[model samples]
Target chain A: MPMRTVRFLFFLLSIAAGIGLGLVYGWLIKTPDPGQLTPQVLRADFKADYVLMVAQVYQRDQNLAQAVQRLSRLDPASPARTVAQALLTARDLQYDPADLQVMSDLSRALQSLETPAATGEPAP
Target chain B: MNDNESRGNLYLFTGLILGLAVGLLISLVISPVEFVDIDPSAMGEAYRNEYRLLIAQAFQSDGNLQRARERLALLREADPARSLAMQAQQLVGEGASPADARALALLAAALTNPQGIAFTPQPSPTLPPGEEAQTTREVGQAIFTPTPPLPTRTPVPTFTPRPTATPMRALDAPFVLESRQDVCDGSLPAGRLVIEVFDRDGNPMAGVPVQVVWGQNQTSLFYTGLAPEISPGYADFQMEAGVVYTLRVGAVSDTLNDLSVPACGGGVRVVFREGR
Candidate 1:
């Protein structure tokens, strides 16, 4: 082959290799775990406003039972849980049949959550 | 390699490195990752202030003057808006009696928006002189003071006690007892019956059975209970002139058989009328 032609071929091959390497490096560096981007397991740190909006809608519709149920379904550890629980308590105060046992149960549930969890292994 | 080809290759390589460096520098400047530790104490203090304000508002709405005052006092101690706290304190100090103080405080608290507090309503402490004293005393004496009166015949014909008249009127029934005065966060006038039913936690109890009694006859009125379809909270009942009434509130349960009300526990008497 002519010397110029040979040099041209070599340059083309080098450019192709460089382009291929760049493509592979970009793919490897850019990939992210699918699980991390899922909607279900996303941390609910900033969901208070949405939760409160739903609760208020339930309340406005005078569906205290449904409001309470929806509120209870939320993760207890969520910051929104406090506001949800407060609204539920308010509903109970206004309308729930005054079952002392229910009140007692709620008190117990609040206390249990408020206390720190034990870390020691279970007894044999 | 020839000189011309070498120069072209060098330019391409230099351009690629310069472009890559520029891109990286732009990314670093525009969207740098940052780590910050939130000040929990400052956040907590802010939350506490908000909670205090909310409690004050609820109390004010319910005509609980004393409670409003107490909450505002706590808020003041916490160094929340100094001017607003001082204003609340001034209003509370003007209350004449303990009951007046409580009613005014609660009313003041209720006036604030619920969103402002972002907290649950705490149980209100029972106010002293809750309508009980007004019934037992002679019709005229009950209006003025707590003391029992000396039997004396005034020239003005003494108001005859009616044995058959219903003691309390229901909101939905024929005699719709509208709040004549803006009793919102204010004193409950003498001879007025304000019945508030509460559960064991002191939370307002809804839909309990309430009875108004006078002399020998008693009338039963179910508190328009709070259902999923209904508004939650107490069914407000007010008193009218010349008629004495007693309230009997039932327990918060389906079995209504467990009706336990303090006003009727020993039998309370309320005389309803406009002005003494």
Candidate 2:
């Protein structure tokens, strides 16, 4: 081919190669990596709040055993630990073996906590 | 170079430049971008308004005219917005003491502009009717000083029943048994028999299963299957005259350890002479 034609072809090929490199770079930058995102950690405050709420419900049901069990499961260093300890102390002061219903309800509640959450339900 | 070749080269270069420019413009236009929508001025005004409402509610709940007056005074200094200042001035005039009223007024005034407000003491305004007044006063006192003495009432004493102790006969074998009645009169008894088991160390073990067997002649009087109810740690068996009965308590723990007392095998061999 003549010199002018050869130079024109070289220039056209260079532009095409540049466009292809640009497209590849864009695709690589935009591609997402599933492993890069970490699963969300439960906030410490939320955990404490949940434990306190469950403890209050158990206390209302007069299930001291269950309340104590729930209290024991709470993070010992959490701010809610003081509340749990207070409740446990109060329960010890009033505990009576003759209160069979209270005892049974407490055992049942504590056992229920150990069971896995039902399908499509959030864990407490 | 030749005329045709030069023209072709010029055309190609122009096309590439135009394509590159267009692509760059399209990328810039389509790229995702985010912006904050809240107006800073409006946010500041909202904070001021919220603080005002909180202070007013607090004063109403506490019934502390003095604290209310002080808060209004502070509010007047901060905002001087004719409406807020006038409201604070009115609260102060309404029997609120100078010192407490002044403190509240100052807090409100300091919060008039967001810049001066350190932390909005978002007083909980939704307290129950019964607790509203007490809680408001508590909040006031908490801010001004330590909590004040709460009204005290003596608690009434409650009575609890004590468990009764009944003398039980010692079993020579592994167990001793007792029932509500040795013989039945066809009418069911009102109460149930409760059995308690204690380990050698005397601690109670829960969830022990017991098997009871009873019968008269060739037929069983009442099998464990037919009993109406049984207490925890105990088995109920219906009694019929002219029947021989036996009970067997079997536990896996007993079988695992040779010395572990079979939770079973407590015979209270009662040979009834007459129906009671």
Candidate 3:
């Protein structure tokens, strides 16, 4: 091979090696701190369990406002949306029928809260 | 010729360094690994606190200690009961909702003493009159059959009510002063008032609120179980020498007067137990 070509090939190989090392370091060597993680990143099943917990609390306290506030921590987009997603996950995971019931109850309550506002009627 | 070869080698080395930098930038900044399925143990401090709170509230709602323990295990705490007690105390200190603090404390107590403890039902918040029935109907509609039957999954045992189950003792049962003793140990803290609370069955009860008042109604409130190392149902307060104090446990406990550092120079130990 020509001397110039050989040098060029070596340069490209070095770059490839460097990229591999960088990927390893970034992906494996120095991952994000676990303590800094947010609840939004929780596993789908765990997220469902968390939603179920809020539902249970609501069952006892009948406090819709507090339930919605707690659910918002897990998913900021919407509390009702969060519960609906959790209900689906719980069904797929075969969560206890009682637990599924609780999540569904929460989903319905949250939807009810939104319905009045969406329909341009004064909230009941 | 040697100098040219060295220059070429340097160029290759530079290329490698440039590649590494770019790779790290991409991996760490632009497209860092997103955590989608982490367990409770890996959660950040705030989320973990929220998880613990939820666990406590669930325990309160259902009165299930074993389930609470299993859920707490997900947090991976060295001492789940103690962690809960400390968090409860901290929550109370921070002036958070009394219900929330009480829920945490109740769970901590249950973990400390497995024997059943009666808890007052939390007052349900009232909703608008028209919406109450609607909410109830929605909750009633949630009972449905599972779409997929998993024959492999073992059936969960149904909870059976025991006809002869012993009635649980109320957590707020009036507490009577059982014993008062003066400690003379030099090693122990001076002028400290150590209080221990117990249930009727003699099991140490955790999370009973102890109140101390002195000098024109200046009061201090603390809960038991803060020092699980000594005992789950133990709490202490420091008393100034010659300052008289009155102490009480729970909401309906009889007050004991003239509580002060005894002349023996160690401290006073008071034991309280549930009364009929």
**How well does each candidate superpose onto the true structure, as a TM-score?**
0.19, 0.17, 0.77
When superposed on Cα atoms, how far off is each prediction in RMSD?
Answer: 25.1, 28.9, 9.8
The segments of candidate 2 whose C-alpha lies over 4 angstroms from its true place after superposition are A1-124, B1-173, B176-210, B213-235, B239-246, B249-276
Q: lDDT per residue, candidate 2, B20-135, as tens digits?
A: 55443333333312111111111233333433443443332222233333333432343333344344444444644333333343333333422222122323234355642221
Interface Cα RMSD, each model: 20.4, 18.0, 5.5
Q: lDDT of model 2 at residue B197? A: 36
Candidate 3 C-alpha lDDT tens digits along B163-236: 11122345667998999988987755899999998877776776688889999888878777766657767889
lDDT of 3 by residue, A1-124 (tens): 9987988889899998888899888877887676688777666666777887899889878999999889988888899999988888767765657777777888889998888556667767
B103 Cα displacement, candidate 2 (Å): 58
Ranking by DockQ: 3, 2, 1
TM-score (chain A only) of candidate 3: 0.80
lDDT of 2 at A43: 22
Top model number, TM-score: 3
List, residue by residue over A1-124, the lDDT tens digit for candidate 2: 9987977776676566545544443333433332221101112221222233344334344555544544443333432343443334334433223322333444455556556667986667
Cα-based RMSD of candidate 2: 28.9
Worst 10 residues of 2 chain B by lDDT: B136-145
TM-score of chain A of each: 0.30, 0.26, 0.80
Estimate how well candidate 1 is docked, as a DockQ score.
0.02
